[model samples]
Target: MLSKLFSELKRLPRYAILLAALTALGMTAGLYRLYAGLGATTNMSKVFPWGVWISFDLTTVALSGGAFTLAALVYVFHMHDLHAATRPTVLFGLLGYSSVLVILFFDLGRWDRFWHFIVYPNINSALFEVSWCIAIYSIILIYEFSPVIVERFGNNRLLEWIKKLTIPMVIAGITLSSMHQSSLGTLFIVMSPRLHPLWHSMLLPVFFLLSSIPAGISLIIIGSIVSDMLFGHSLSQRVLEKLGWLMPWFLGLYLALKLGELLVTEELGLLFSSGKYSLLFWLELVVGVIVPMILFSIKSVRWNRWGTLTAAMLVAAGIVLNRFDATWFAILPRQGVTYSPHWLELALLVGVASGVLLVFTILSTYFPVFVETMPTRKPQEAAVEAGRAERAPALSGD
Candidate 1:
């Protein structure tokens, strides 16, 4: 009996176990911080009310922005070839928005008063707009995601109801996502005087919206690759190819807009300056943008599976790096200091992420996130089987 139980446990996914452990640790830290108050726990102070949570947690909402981009492509624009990518992206966005709200609650001084935005109604605040948009978008995402559950249960009536509302919900999601994504950039626009010129621009909203394209695509790519690594099912090569084609075009536009803005604003010299800010700025441009663009523009790189994975990782890192520079690094000159997250704060982030991954794992495991069953064979095994076709057939051969 003990042997059978151990066998069952061994069959469980490793990621699920990791998530469970991290989630437990994160929750323990979070609950302690909740009762202990922010003063006793976090490193955040008067000069820096935001730290890693704001940079990492908040930026993740945009990272999850891939849901809307994919929704618009497959649903609104009717790119049916890409439909397989949509459900997973929507699931990702749901978790992302949920995680951001949870992180925001942790960051609050009066966590209980979070609902005050709805009750008091501040029409003038950028945060107010962002709050409303996220709230509405979260609800829409719930509706959008319901079909997954309904379909899993084979509930035709509920599925039909969800289908009727699907188009409207997708449209609403795209609209509200646009609002909050750009509004995130708008939040920093008001801080222009304090923002490093290399990081600040009047076209902040445009950049945010524009960046969302590659951000969303890169994340989907990374997620697709991860799912392949973890489960062996992935989007078809054509769909990924389509996504790869998009990055170079979008990056080209972004590079032009950013470089032109720097040149026109006379901040071009800063690109060559000596400082931590300049160093980070160049890293963001070079590692994140230029390298990915050059690699992706090469047809051989974007079309090859491994090459595509490398390009996607670069794009994801680049977007995250750019957001980080904008949110924390660029503001250092004004604050006259550096900031880092507290251990508890880092724990909360880990916990939040673990929870998100746990939810995704549970849903994907049970639901039809992919229409195809994931292969059980590893990539090397599959390759070997391909080489010895008559002697061995792999799980992915069909």
Candidate 2:
């Protein structure tokens, strides 16, 4: 078992090298930011207490909802068709949530005093609830993902133990994710007076949860394409094709909700008003929402890899814009404030993103993240390789 694990690790030298480089760079920037303070390094101000880190955290965690969604389908809905994609989804989810936690440390004004969030435990504070939920959800993700590592390392005892905990962990994950995801939107509830009426609805939490479904699935589709291109194998085409079917339904529901909210609130006209906010609103609706839905509606286009990739990219981009619009852009004008990230904040964002990519690359190379064989490849090719191995026996005999 040890030998097998070591062999897997040894096969991933390039990933290890990349991870090392990213770690060095991230730690250096992180340390510098800590020593200098956010004002000294980042473009953050009293007006914009949150910047790149908050945006990144919101986007990444929303995308990580893929894990809970997948788990729900497999365990609760009995959709075993998605089972193959679960492990990789869980792994990515864990990394995504963990990365958000790390970024939050850098985001706080008093980095050293962050422990007060846990130690003081303000029961009435929404921020406190969000923080604790995120912390617990991260732990749930770790446990959900640990089974794969145990299986790969051939630790039967550990694997058995983890399997026993899977049911409880899945429940915990669903509950925690539901709380924080909504809480993320609720973070803006206090700022309602500062947000544009078009975006300040009480249903922000529902909109956030609804939008997350498509965004999470889109990330999975894009992640699958990247794995196929880089690793020379497809994970599950049937699952992805089914995911294509699922996208439109979620997109339709989300669009309907937004339109309904606008109509009910008499704010639909804001889509055309001339301003930066209007431009962003239209951009989010048109590029992020409308274009993808139109392209994906065509059966031929939905099945095409490039089309799917484009849609996924747009959906992901739309989610980012939506969050920014909700948390920053939508609130800024009302507050009569603006913000742009300084070089240090930008560097920290890049460093954290690089770190996540580095970790994913290493793990995929060393573990069974991608399928062992191409699901879409010809059977004859596999047969030919097997035949060649048999024929080579004569040379060894001689």
Error of 2 at 221 (Å): 0.2
Estimate, for each residue in 1-398, the C-alpha lDDT of model 2 and write its tens digit.
99988765555534445556766787788889889887888877777777877888898988988998888878877888887778778888989987888889988878789788888987867789999998888888888877767777889988888788777788888888888888888777788767777677778888888788888888888777765544444556667767777788888888888889989888888877748778888888788888888777878877788788888889889999998787677765525568877877777776777688778767765666755335344556533432232232222221
lDDT for model 1, please: 0.81
Model number with the top TM-score: 1
* Overall local distance difference test of candidate 2: 0.77
Q: Model 1, range 1-398, lDDT digits (tens) per residue? A: 99987754453355566678999999898889899999788888777777888888657977898988989998999988888888888899999989999889988889989999998987767789999999999998888888888888899987987799888888988999888888888888888876788889988887888888888998888888767655556887778888888888888898899889998999899887848888988787788788989988888887798899888888788889888888777875444666777889999998998899888876776677765423436767643432333221221221
TM-score of 1: 0.90
lDDT of 2 at 294: 79
lDDT of every model, 2 decimals: 0.81, 0.77
